[model samples]
Target: MTASPSSAYPYRLRLPGPITIPERIRQATARSIVNHRGPEMRVILEEIQQWIKPLFGTTAPVLTFGSSGTGVMEASLANVLAPGEKVLALVHGQFGERYAQIARALGAEVDVIESEWGWTPDPAVIAAKLDKNDYRALVAVHNESSTGAVTDLAAIGALLRDRDTLLLVDSVSGLGGLELRQDEWGVDIIVTGSQKALMCPPGLGFASVSEKARKVIERDDRCARFYLDMRKALAVVDKHETAFTCPVSLLFGVHEALTMIHEEGLPQVFARHKRLSDAMRAGCVALGLPAFGDQATASHTVVVASVPEPLTGGAIVKHMYETYNTAIAGARNKLTGRVIRIGTMGLISEADVLTDLYFLERSLTALGHAVPTPGCGVAAAVASLS
Candidate 1:
């Protein structure tokens, strides 16, 4: 039987009430909606573009859409590759497969390098595939959420540096939470959403395009879908606006979130995320749970752990939520009922990690599963930090 949703504890740690709105932006947005094509709206649009560049580690114009990250993912393919153009895709988990699917749906020839779900794709494997095919682009996920794997972007970028292939990345879960340098890595197109590391409620999607990717968009023989067309987005953004009505509330939320990130400093924020991730992994190890991903390929945002046979991942998640009010992600696809995912991104803290450990241990015991001492996970996390 499935656990009841009402009995779920939501989250053990209280997240700050909906992101705090900056008084100035709130007051400005609270005024009646501005004309979408007016000069005043242009200023707001330009400010948003300028603000987004730094977060992405790029000086290029960043495009915004009032849609999910999937929108940008589709846009990246639609704008760059023509029908039947070849692409070498690297698949480490579900997101990678999604990229391949999107490219194929757009009529691009997709040559995929499939890796074990919980492991990073080997660069050598990708290089071998590239050697055989003259693909116009290569797609990879910076962070694989389903399997909790982190691909080495720098290595992958280096491999594609001299090739004509555009290095497209799905950084939805990695942006701001992990180290990503769009310019330095030679990435042609990078897509991210507002919810994860940006610490804003969902609704906004962002993409950073390189000169190479832009050129491909111009040269592609096939016309892109009007709404998902990147060329159109770029044209409007060049005038400091969007091709369609924007998500004003979410844009305001992004402005506030970006301000907070800048104030905290990007490097410091990255360090905090890394520290939290390391601590969470340590906590998992301390609890006698083996991490699902190979140690060398673990993602910073989510940690996947193998649960004992009788307990099941669902039961563990249910117990943690119902008994401790802590919400955690569960395994997906083939990993269902096998692994539990603990996400330590955005505003999560070390104290939250310790608390999760305490509850996880208690919940396991309550479920008639044996676990180590209460602070074992906490100590492991601290040791990893040290």
Candidate 2:
């Protein structure tokens, strides 16, 4: 029988996220509750804004959501764009399409600029799409996590900076881990989750909004959302409180996680993630598994590699998780058994990468693939790190 949810599974790690939290943050998550409206909580809230601002590249206070990153994406759409406004939602993967779905559900006339699963939406193509339609906003994912494809937001931003449309970015997996400058990129709205690169478990999410988007939200009386109304939520910003009761425990954990990020420094933190990603890509190369896309657009967050003929992604994932108890993510839904997705997103070092590589090589070998050089994958990875 499988281990119970609460039971400790026999694995070195479980996931890229809900990733192994530092012991201190884990303890903080379990700490005694504080009143969400109390003075102590106010201090925590104030500190969180200060702690999180640099990550989002915003001087304006970031809005916190008591849900997943998708929640923030939906909330952002609901709060800013009104009914009948056209939104160009770029789709390169599942999450990108998700943003489109949310827009469609909310009555926005959605136009999609789609690319193949393993490729990122081209900025020039997107720029042309914008010119063809008088779009109110452009919804794009900075890093297409589902396919391990990274979009060129900087180039996209350069094209749109002087345009009339707003740029709403879903940087859920890219924000803290990858290089993202919301303000510098002229991203009107940016959303991210706590689980990915924040070194915390999933629980809360937040959005950083620019002045233009804030005004658009303030003036869009047609927007009927109550809970996600940034106007309502920001009403008490000076008081360091939210529109509703906040999750104090998750806030504690996020704050602790942000503290850890600060300790590492953002530049070094991003570099560490890059190092881990490089090692992962190198190891995959040594295993004779080609990456899903070229290195230029590859995600620093995760490595998506094509599963060779006769070696199903399902079998390897099953063997890794069930037999070795080392969990790695699989493909985007449509091509489930065709590709394997592995993440080095949060709280992982070279040692962790080595361990995961060892398991992946062994899993492939056990499944009848030839590892011409038994330890080469790990060696390549280690050399990349050094």
The lDDT values for all models are 0.80, 0.84
Per residue, candidate 1 scores C-alpha lDDT tens digits across 129-171 of 8888898889999988888898888899999899899999998
Off by more than 4 A, model 1: 1-34, 38-40, 382-386
Q: Which candidate should be chosen as best, given lDDT against the real structure?
A: 2
For the record, the alpha-carbon RMSD of candidate 1 to the native fold, in angstroms, is: 3.2
User: In terms of TM-score, how similar is model 1 to the real structure?
Assistant: 0.90
Residue range 80-168, candidate 2, lDDT tens digits: 88898899988989899999999998889999988988788877888788778888788999888778888887787787788878888
User: Candidate 1, after superposition: displacement of residue 206 in Å?
Assistant: 0.6
**Model 2 off-target regions past 4 Å?**
1-9
Prediction 2 TM-score vs. true: 0.95
